[model samples]
Target chain A: MTRLTRAEAKARTRERLLDAAARVFAQKGLAGASVDEIAEAAGYSIGAVYSNFGGKEQLFVELLQERANDRVNRAAEIIAEAEPAEANGALGRLLVEVADKDADFAPLQAEFWLYAVRNPELMETYAERMREPRRLLTDLVARSVPDAERAGELSSIVIALFQGLVRMRRVDPDSVPDELFGRALRWLFTGAEADEEQP
Target chain B: MTRLTRAEAKARTRERLLDAAARVFAQKGLAGASVDEIAEAAGYSIGAVYSNFGGKEQLFVELLQERANDRVNRAAEIIAEAEPAEANGALGRLLVEVADKDADFAPLQAEFWLYAVRNPELMETYAERMREPRRLLTDLVARSVPDAERAGELSSIVIALFQGLVRMRRVDPDSVPDELFGRALRWLFTGAEADEEQP
Candidate 1:
């Protein structure tokens, strides 16, 4: 293994801890999951998790922040390339890219939602931790469709549809086709598939 | 109300128990939820819950069965209408109609999923619950696209997208417009919006 500088070592350890936390959370869920199990998964001691993040819930919030950030950062690139009325496919592609990039992401979304439902504490922290997706998509939709308000409506539904589809597919692969996420949105954004329908 | 016969009372009481259980499960979730709470919610004594369902887990399974049977009963009406090409849109409309008919339904769907995550034992049951939605969509996609197997990639994605949209909209009303659900599918199933795209 390559030797790391002090900063690199810190980053690596943080990443390892986060990785461990995801598996622990997935396996045990929020209420049943513990810091010790998370530490064990990361190949570190419990202290490492505490040292990096104050507690189990804090660690979970950190995990949520990282994931939410990753999505926004990735989406920004897709949006940057988009132009007025020219982003018909760009918006759809960005979402498809997300669905295709990580098979495990949808489960985390569902798991976090389950967390939010069970614990009222997480619900209030949502805008603080996870409002970017809605905000960004709203802006993207406004840009892509005319009549910004009406267009935004379509965009929001498409987004909701996209998210719902991901959760369903992750939970049961046999039931939902993998690429249906983008195809559905493509139909919404471009209105390209409408004519393909049989009369 | 007319006085019920013995069997009628038994059936009525069971229905009340299930309704109460649904509310408790939706509010507190399956793991954190209790049998006593369910019984109380149903306006019955704790002894009644045990007498009727045995325990919390068994109550949960029965809840799943009841929800499944309810949907199956709804699908029976749709099965008689053999316009498979139009069936996908029909399913989307059904979801909307559900929300319009009873605002409580989607929240309950979210709760059912929360239970699925808290107890892995519920995963199989949840998957079974999802089968009808998939079967409905797949059969429709097959009739419309004719290359459904080859288009498996896109099909999976649309399912996820549909679930995501439904859940997101159900969770937040302002962010998701009411019309997009039906309109998007109409566009997807027919070419209602074909003129909007640039040639």
Candidate 2:
């Protein structure tokens, strides 16, 4: 192991503990795993987990919600940089970037969604956070279409397509091609132009 | 109450039980709720839940998986009747129909999806069953596009789009729009046409 200064060692140890807890919680599930086991996995003492997160459930929530927020925030920041007119392509890229972007967090998220339903308070928190992504898309849709409420059926389809792509990529990565998102982007943005040229 | 034959009464009771269970499950969650409460909400005895479904977990699975299969199968049959070339359009119709078709079951399915991850065996069952619809699309894809492997990317996008739509509709029904599904269908089936219209 590389030698570490005191603060660096503490931070690294905390990160390790979080990683171990995440893995155990994800693989064995929240109810199935124990704090002691998490400590062992992290090569830390049980006191480490307690010191870092206080307890398992809170740790689980922090690992999931905070991390998801970080990701969405990063993706949204990328979207913020996009031209208003390029909203469709931008949104698609953001979503695709999110979907195929990283695998480490995806399964944990998949596990969290499971937790969200099984736990109602988490569900409320989830529902609250869910609105943020939708709100972002709604704004993007407004920019691209200029008359979203009037855009009628199109807006919902827009959200659904992004959601569908995400779900599919999760279940089977190979099935969702790299260009897949680009095609949807072009169509949602370009309308008849993208629609006709697809596949 | 109208008097009914044994079969009719049994059917009505089963339906009532399912509806009540969905509400309770939605309110209390998959893990938190018990069968007695569901039975009480249905105005039936505990025996009713036990006799019809045996337990809350099994009942939850039945509602989420078996019932969903039946609906999708029926939807598949309808899609099968459409012209071979128009199958994608048929699928779009199928998805739109699902969005509008029944409100109760959709939310339940979404809840079930979130809940399944907690139980890997259930998740596997779900993941497997979820693939059935994808298989339908895969076969349809193989037929419509001679180079199915090449179309893998497109296929996944379409599949994801459909799954995502179902999810969104449950969250906010009005936002999804009526023609959204059809539009996606038209675009997905007429891929090249969709693209050409874009650029």
- Write one digit per residue (lDDT tens) for candidate 2, span A26-70: 555565678899999999878988887869888888776666456
Provide the TM-score for each candidate, comma-separated.
0.67, 0.59
What digit string (tens of lDDT, one per residue) describes model 1 on residues B163-199?
5565554445455455555556566544323422432
| Each model's DockQ score | 0.34, 0.26
Per-residue alpha-carbon lDDT of model 1 for A38-141, expressed as tens digits?
A: 89889999888877888988888788767644665466557656674545456556555555566456556666665654455665455344445656666666
True contacts kept of 1: 0.45
* Docking class for candidate 2: acceptable
Query: What overall lDDT, based on C-alpha atoms, would model 1 receive against the true structure?
Result: 0.62
DockQ value for model 2? 0.26
- Chain B TM-score (model 2 vs. true structure): 0.69
Q: C-alpha displacement of A84 in model 1, angstroms? A: 12
Candidate 2 similarity to native, TM-score: 0.59
Q: What is the lDDT of residue A108 in candidate 2?
A: 58
Model 1 chain B poorest 10 in a row by lDDT = B190-199
